[model samples]
Target: MAASPDTLARVEELTARRLNRTLLARQHLLARSTQTAHDLIHHLVAVQAQESNAPYISLWTRLEAFEKDDLTALLADRRAVRSSILRGTQHIATDDDYPWLRPTVQPVLDRGRQGAFGRVTAGVDPVELAALARKHLTGQTLTRPALARLLAERWPDVEPLALGWSAQCLLPVVHPPPSGTWGRFGATPFVLAEEWLGRPMAAPDAERLVVRYLAAFGPGSARDVQAWSGLTRLREVLERLPLRRYRTPAGVVLYDLPDAPLADEDAPAPVRLVPEFDNLLLAHADRTRVIADAHRRVVITGAVVRPTFLVDGFVRGMWSMTGAGIVLAPFEAITEAARDALTREAAELLRFAGTEGSVSFTAPGH
Candidate 1:
């Protein structure tokens, strides 16, 4: 049975470490899940895919036995899709989730278009542009540049880049396979979502969006949901939902599904090599649960969230793959135990990446 709102109102106060453990459990970072790549993508609602290899690396770290082919096959089979959704950025969502998820987050895309191309698209009919874009993208895929030129032919006065981006934000278009496939890289191409998936998008539902967000990245505040989805005014929506609430040590109210399990604050956390643009680092407004403010500044630099290694469930350093192999750059010195753990995790990452190289470390902050 669901807990009554009255029962839920006696809010529990969650310590920061408690929030950290719960987040790790929900994200499957405390332990790699046995779930398949497709199901994990759906449960996540969307996997950040700004970098072509990001989704692959993200899944590799979270799944028990994930291979590059595990996700590559999904894109090839049309069971997964890559498009702009959460925060108006590139993400790979399951075919079933995209139909509804895209619509739910459409407002964010619309707002992005206005902020980016509203002035450039002045005096241009957005509805007409969207229709024409859909028509061009109906049965065939076109690269962004090609689509831009085509749209410019109709509105000769507008900037081609603006026109292309405007169309992208206005229409539910997707980048087909090879666009987001592992080890693949190139200019992004688009096809109408309906044409690509052979299904129409469902109507937007903010309520469902909130529930999914909490499931994956929860015990979060309204601000966190808004931050993650790039949609605002969620507090009202949150108030109407049947979620249980808790207070942070700072007195901030956090909402979660009534049945959701909270991990014990003392639960052990393994070292993890989180990928760049991974949603785990971007999902919450108050990121201190998973990363310290000082470490965050080093990990996130003006739109780029560098790949990081976690120690004791918190970010301890940044890492990257180089010709020399995996390089670990810690912000501060780590204990010998943490160093040994990171070394082992790094070796596994190399094997998963299918690369031959040695793992090296630099002095703190180097």
Candidate 2:
């Protein structure tokens, strides 16, 4: 006989529970790791920022010995930078990452600006405008309004908001420190990422980026990556990657690195308080792994991503800082033991925040 037509079986299946714990471990949510702030930022690729103090708290919640000074030093020293990239939102990324990250995501920003802001900035040469924007921002830090007003002087006919937002969308800009400092609010300043970091923007390499996404948030589908990054048409990139593929019992294809960690289905998941816009919660197309179907809308609104906590590697509820203390609102009731764990962690968070805050709870569905 020539040969058996049937080949050896392939690819392990990943249950939602296993997926949850694996992701938690990769993100350092199960337990705080000792990775330096710079290394963590580089590994995670970026932290969802723009909300002051979110980045600092994010590091604190994920790094064992994290302190405010750890992150503040990176921003002050320019080893890291804050800028708009994935999904065109403000994020803090290391100098090593942004060069490649910014170029890769430029098309996403272009599409967003063209579809939304371009309607108002119609007929403006974006190429020329980008050049002018870079020129205006070179060796200078200008707030949005100031930069807008200056650019508007030349194109007085265009809406100043459009002109300003165009520069924001089109440029690889950084809002340096004292800007992201907790509780400090004023003019939001911008500088070119290349100038601030002294590294040129890297060429777009979609293949490598797909691998990075897999490393950080993987065993996920292309749609998950698209949902996380807000970049579309990534199927080609995913297809080209040398990925180890798996499927859920439901048959959803999941991709991963050949050696990526996939934890046991029964692994324990500790409670972790994450800041608003935590990328872990935002990284999947099917987030039922980390969030329930009914509770998703409650966590995210139009532009606001609420701070949330994970119980057993899933978003058990939401939390917030109030005048009196940290408030925990569970979507479902928890055991006394879980409640006690949350209370202890809340105190740690309060101390990290330099607050005399206490923990308060509300009934499920309240």
Candidate 3:
């Protein structure tokens, strides 16, 4: 029998460059893999999906045979869903996974909701609110405002908007198909996840989840996992895992599954255009692994996650779908040949978005 990955290799030192390549490879960013959208969602745990079409664009950059409908079909087939998961935001999770992952992240969601809308919902019984939300939303899809109005009748004392936002935060609800479908903005209608899927949400399991995160995003510290997941005290979980461990060039300790592969430090990574809120950028607390300090704030300014692209496994520029055309604003200059390659990739990205767009650029230095 093969030795366990934990036992086979002693932990090795990793440089930032080596860490970046390993991250890209595990994330399927080093090369486009041929996995279907459904399989990819499960493997990655969740893909950041705040925008209506961002998940589709993300899959396009990571999968070879990915089609817009491949993800659409997963949603239609109830094989996948978009709901609040990690860090209290929308993510695409498989049908079998969301139930447990949802409950696991509830505290994070609760913390965010309480901070955002809790003052208005003060003294409200969350249990009662969640039950009423389930009752009102079961077997029906309703927008936030409309559902707020319905819920307000029950708690007329509470502000309807607060109630609506609270229901969203507290319940395991999903925005229905047309809402997250590519190139569409159907009313942000929501329904109970349990009712829609004909299955109950499984209980949260932090140990298993931590292990999975290590499998995908690891050789990472507990802080990194918490950054990706928004839960805390994960160092306690990492302490118990039977995995190899390493320290980065910065001397930060990281842990990983015993058998996980570490590519050579100088591994090649192609340029990849990612949509707003891409998990690669959002998942790690120490984002220097993929994004430099100078550009991090601009990439994720308050409530504005500008689109970004990865060149050689690290973020190099911002992009947009402006009316004039597809635009790239690089923070630094690149070779003319590199510019040519970026242009071709941007053109393909435009086509994937179902728009005919000319690629444009904002040269370095204004």
For all candidates in order, the CA lDDT equals 0.91, 0.86, 0.85
Write candidate 3's Cα lDDT for 146-259 as tens digits: 999999998899889899889999999987787788877755788899888889988889988898898788789888999999999888888887977787655567889989
TM-score head-to-head 1 vs 3, winner: 1
TM-score of predicted model 3? 0.94
* lDDT of each residue in 292-351, candidate 2, tens digit only: 878889998877889998888899999998768899999998989889999999989998
Model 3, stretches more than 4 Å misplaced? Answer: 1-11
Clashing pairs in 2: none
- The positional error of residue 119 in candidate 3, measured at the CA in angstroms, is 1.6
Q: Model 1: runs farther than 4 Å from truth?
A: 1-10
Residue range 247-315, candidate 1, lDDT tens digits: 776667889999999999999999999999898989889999999999898889999999999999999
Q: Rank the candidates by lDDT, best first.
A: 1, 2, 3
Worst 10 residues of 3 by lDDT: 1-10
